[model samples]
Target: MKATTVLAVVCVAACLSIHASALSPFGVGRSQLHKKRWWSSVDVNDLHKYHLDDDPQGYFGYLTQPMDHFDPLINKHFNQRYWVVDKYWKSKSHPVFLYEGEEAELELGEVAYGHHAEMAQAHGALILGLEHRFYGNSTTKEGLLLSELQYLSSQQQLADLAVFRVFAEKKLGMSGTNTWIVIGGSYAGALSAWFRLKYPHLVYGSVASSAPVRAQANFEGYNEVVAASFADPIVFGSEKCVASIRQGFSKIEQMKQAGQLAQIVKDFNTCQDMTDPNDFKTFASDLQGTFMSAAQYNYIEGNSSSIGTLCQQMMVPDPYQALVKMFNPGSTCSDVSFKDFLKLLTDVTFDPGAMSRQWFYQTCTQFGYYQTCDKNTTCMFLPEVDLDYYFAWCKGGYNIPSSDVLEQVNFTNAYYGADNPRGTRVIFVDGTIDPWHALSVLKDLPEGLKSVFMKGTSHCADMAPNDPDAPPALKAGRLEIEKIVSGWLMQAEMEKKHK
Candidate 1:
């Protein structure tokens, strides 16, 4: 084996060998983590305790460490563990940790710990993190599965939360009911709703900020939205309909049909000082995955300074060559035939109108479109690659069908029935200017849910008002969310108990 391959194996072995007893199948605790207490002001940072049963003194040393076979240049690794105080004076309430979303470990929760955990602590609650099952320091088999180990059909990762609750309750010394609150943004918001649905008894309620629960809806619609939202209006100059972007895309499609798409990509990429070149290149590039191309394009369009990097990734130096290697290690670029290449490009296209047609006729009966394509009345869709489901499980293709992109549009319409009485509460928060939120198809949320609109911003919404740099309204909003969440949890609990 090559050095990199051998090193990856070693790391995988080390991870697999790490001692983790199945004290609780899902990390549930046998006892509560903290004593009952009513305090005026709770210090989130000052709080530190976990209910791991083996450690008698209850001190859990924690740190972030690198995990197996990571390329030092591209990947980061770290682990976070918690140590808790003994069970003395502890209340009956057991604390449950809520893990943040998408390729993050549990520590990201600490990033938003200003008042979340503190408030729970004041209520005699033990707040533990719901770690991502195959991410960060948590691993299963060579990080290969890191891309697609597990997820809910709703794209909900609630099962991980349930398992974590069991872990904390039994192994971590947590007690009473698993009354944990689910919290997060964007993808995490979707998770919050999933948790409440999967284990109503365990999770009191969810504080989903920008939840996208309608799984596999308009995966492309979200990409288009985010791209449009971040693209420099100065470059486009005016908001003409989606047609403005479509006009730009039309040129590439024509070129693609003429067997000149590659040259078109080359010309735009090679231009010395191309105006709005990244957007043009994104439209032209034959990216194998969905969402990734748009995401890269959006980044470049938004951060003008990053244009050079975007150029390099798409064309100039062709950064995608390296990624292609990761996807099909040791395979030559030319090995991909023209037909295969075209199929890849076609699938990656993010045309909403086209996808809606396909879902209704081509795919399965998940999202309401149940008719089969045949004979005269066959569902007519533009001939394009179905990248959403194509490279979904491939290596390094996680973002191709990012949970947000999938759950927000076509998936929502198909799989996530809008009027289902699941009592699913969803909070779709987005900046008024955030293009991604605009294209969201997260429908069927419970009437009780609240979707917040953060004015004039992109994807960054967590650290509002108190950033020492945040707006006043943001500060107030941050603190007020607790009460909103508390009420939701109480209502959910009441429904379950009295049902």
Candidate 2:
């Protein structure tokens, strides 16, 4: 794809922008108070005005970068805590939550800003974090009303980016002239690539870390990819570990079949530094975390044997800590057990009730070329089995999908990708040790795309750990990025230069 062609695609996409309806239940702003950061209340009345000052008692505003469009009567809304509500209300405004490496939000928008900031700071770029639509303060409403929260989708999220750019440029004082780079890991990384494909004019460059854009969204298909990677001798070091893994998985599968899935999971949590918990909350949380950790990585290899091998490594004594780090990083786990670790691998739920499961189903039936009715007024998923249920299960809770998300709202093109004359640059950073490295979208990335395969990380490379200059190898790669992106942006700005 030529640079000129890429620029044209971006421009054309931007020309087809959508604006949020001011009267929608989601457009009003309200505020609330909290100790850490003040949240605005959700306004149920007017949607055009964005109120910032009506915060609840005891909350402090945390946005370091000031916005001029902020209004006491109308711009910002508050909640008990914006982060939690911001996540729940996504699909309103693109919400951005900063976790500071402690409480990581799994939402794609939050990760994008966090990862982008880390990378921008490393490269000495002036990082102005932009929140996505239906998230954070960017929502059309004051708070997350269960009824209004159902419209979240990738396409809506992308449209929100254009709306946000207009808002940020006018309120946050950015000139769209400035180079905007989109960065993210895992699902968000996939979004970054999709964003460029969808709205090239808004982004100057894109960094997609540990890309997970798969052709099919089936559990069996995803696991096959992971199983194949594990089968590769180079990734596993030895055939013995492979055989042991096979035996372990057979036993684990038997446990699941025998109705001992929950027990094996309980024992695994008990091994996590052995602190006696007053309730089963910690155990359940740990089990879900372990399960997701394994499920996300299952796409790297092609079968059960490879997954079995990976599980065995988590139980061995010499590399136990390493395994723990791989499976459960940033959390305490000094006393966890082999059974505990095994539970994590076997914990994946392919039942329609699981979110990851629902995600694939909803996305596949709608956008994987299956073509159902218009997604705007009618839905492709049945009310009983859908992504909401799956998401609830992942959070270890049950959140009934209200009529809000059950409506036939369009989410089909939310994360779709298309080839363009302007060959889009797609960078995929994978941590070698991160199990997810096995099931990335790099293989499916459009033929002419540019990519960066970061060594030693699960997601995208934020920056090099010890030497902040992005490590030597990344520095070299980014140089090419700088040249390519700078040239592309300059071409867009200068009509006569490339002609």
Candidate 3:
């Protein structure tokens, strides 16, 4: 889920195990959090095989990475963490599958239990997952001061991957013989595709799952897709589900207009009074975000029944009460303070656990994926959660002017070519139910660019380990990805033989 405020920080924790997408500031209901890690279900034997028992870090290693890849004068370097699985690697000719890290820390589970591991076994491939700079323990400096964060951008990240590939090749004794394939989900997914586009010589192919390549400042389409997913029958959502959501928001708006702040607070169980208009907007945004998280991660493993339950709850006569029940299950008081959220976002003091400040900086200067509700007429969120709200957050947090934010967004699209990235052997995968798909490449493009658009699936659903209970489309999609990857390796071998 993507939003403007630190709400994404809260939602990231909720959905992190399921998908590697951008975080949203919107608070996730207690019930929405995944009970177990996504990799917890992986076969124990496979887990043992992938685990690097000899290393103290256990499948994890850190590389000395340049702080500024572009600036020769800046000699500062940091430890960039990575995980590796070479149990399936047969020879120097075997392919290497690299998982690009995103806004969060690099985890061993990423390479140990996903479809990448399954594919690595099938193809005798070496698997690696690299941590993105400034995220997790891959920090460049002591703090997240705006000046320090200047080093964090997609271009620099791609350069890091390029340099790391060379270093990894030397360390693994493969030099230049192995074919490298990059794989990632969500933000990391975008990096995968962009890596191929920017450094095709370094990577043979890319599996970009749920990657939103396009950059939009006022990304109202995010919530628009969320609203659509509420009515999408594939996820067991109905027209009435969407209507109830609208009704719920409408009731909140009516209450605010009638000056029933106390009644609203009592019903929603907010931690603080919503007397301030900004606080009221934050409360509404958090409510809308609960639905966003539900839709964003709908139908994945533990979450398969959540959307259905949400829809059922929304259909209750008093939708306002039902909405409250949906998010504040167990009747917990929600922390809906806009001022506190701002403090979190604006604070530059480095807290490895809280990545919202770093991510929001990226949004302000690079992607501009500010999800606003004002642009869409049928938006289920309050109008007060508009672009101006996000703009205020951006300005307050980073001192980045709204005009500069828009310019940077335009620059990002211009630099990356938005959705029409010129790349080969790239498969762009997206699930219909994922709101982030609005900005991904959903159709086939020239020069071997393809899309694996799955129906009734949510964010990065294809990357999940193949389950017996998984949908047929998802299983087929995985097979199709394998076939494409196999073909790439075979073609590379054929070219090598010819040479």
Candidate 4:
């Protein structure tokens, strides 16, 4: 492996690993949409939020991709969808910035990040956001089953990006002349950095915000970070909240251990009672999964809003009171029971799993980044999950064998330089507040390549529009990134002239 890759791995020796929904990451829902129903039953409308089509002349298009990118000679094609906007620019002479999409579906989220649109306008650049294959409207001819999902992989998606770049240039009659910069956060951020490295000729630079470049096979640190986020009295609002949560966690553990099934059922509000240890473990994982999901995307500040309406519910001084608030924010009239909570969750969530199967499949096959808890650890969670359970989920959910997942992750780490990514003109950004930030690149890279640490931010905090309340660190980081990208544009032009 490369020296950089080795150093990165050693630093973590271990460690672990989405965004744009408000308080959530993918989309926004109106208070009216839920209709006082518990757990917002996620539907196609909930799949993505529709942005106003008032500016930038955004439109959608499709590209034909091979069924199997690795063996393209014999495979057929599928129409993969993408969207682009080019209205706000100095001129066609500016660099083109590609906002890489994430695992979720998207028409696109609001791209009002601090000065990103301004930078594009100032530089006369074009901006295009490509939906990842198997997401949004992108799909294969055979449709979305494991049989057809075999065509899905980052390698395949990256190739689609390369082809899209070529197609885009030809479509705009600006072939080979425009400098290209790629930007994205979360999984999309990972793609942005990876794309530049793999297709250096096609990309001039990249801004990989909150990217977990390394593929962690055993991602135990995920929940630990979540615990740290809540347990910190300084960052989170109340120590009482933290203490109460801890108490509740202990309560649950004791209940599970002593086979206090009645209390366990009453506490979480499960749809069915689980007596079997294996069944109980699944139940435990689901309950904790809500909390884990919240921390991963807790861009709002304190509280686990992503888990439900957690932070909003956290207004109460007591944790159990807050838990009631979390599980039932709309129903101010009365407390919601745990069983009712299950039914509400089934009806309302866009995906009860908290993620699309496409992403889960990718995680199982390529990433292995589920937030499993550690045994004998006090991370405000139970050790109900590990590689065994995760692999079992993969097998059960996607019908994929777990034989090569770890091997594939190892290969990915080696190939991508793990933390030590090999590239120039790439800026890696991670926030202090985000749990995944630990897996992201924070150290300086060689020369034009660098890292930006956004202090007191969460998830794709940088991806959000200019928030006055945003930390000074985030603002300063944006300025530095802007300078770097501007310099890259100039550099690419100079290199072109020399050539």
Candidate 3 per-residue lDDT, tens place, 172-283, comes to: 7884778899998777888889999989999999998878788888887878888888888777888998998889888888888898989989887888897777777777
TM-score order of candidates, top first: 3, 4, 1, 2
Ranking by lDDT: 3, 4, 1, 2
Local distance difference test values of all predictions, in order: 0.35, 0.33, 0.75, 0.59
How big is the positional error of residue 235 in model 3, measured in Å on the Cα after superposition?
1.5
The lDDT leader among the candidates is 3
Model 3: CA > 4 A from native:
1-37, 40-58, 300-304, 329-332
**Model 3 score (lDDT):** 0.75
Model 2, 171-241: lDDT tens digits are 54433355556654444455666776678777655665554443221112222322333444433424454
Positional deviation of residue 368's Cα in model 4 after best superposition, in angstroms? 0.6
Candidate 3 vs candidate 4, lDDT winner: 3
lDDT of 4 by residue, 1-499 (tens): 0000001111111111232221122111110110011112223343223122234467777878776767848556777777767776556566888877666444433342224556777787787878778765676434456676677788888988998898888877674578888887777788889999999999888998778888886776666666766654434534554556666566667766787877656655544566644455555554454455445544443333343344334435555545533433452322222233223222322331222445556776787765566775556756665567667656666656777778878888887888887778788887665667767888897856798886555565565444455457767887888888888888888888999
lDDT of 2: 0.33
The TM-score of candidate 2 is 0.48
Report the number of the highest-TM-score candidate.
3
Model 1 global lDDT (CA atoms, 0 to 1): 0.35
How close is each model in CA RMSD to the real structure? 15.1, 16.3, 3.9, 8.4
lDDT of 1 at 116: 50
lDDT of 4: 0.59
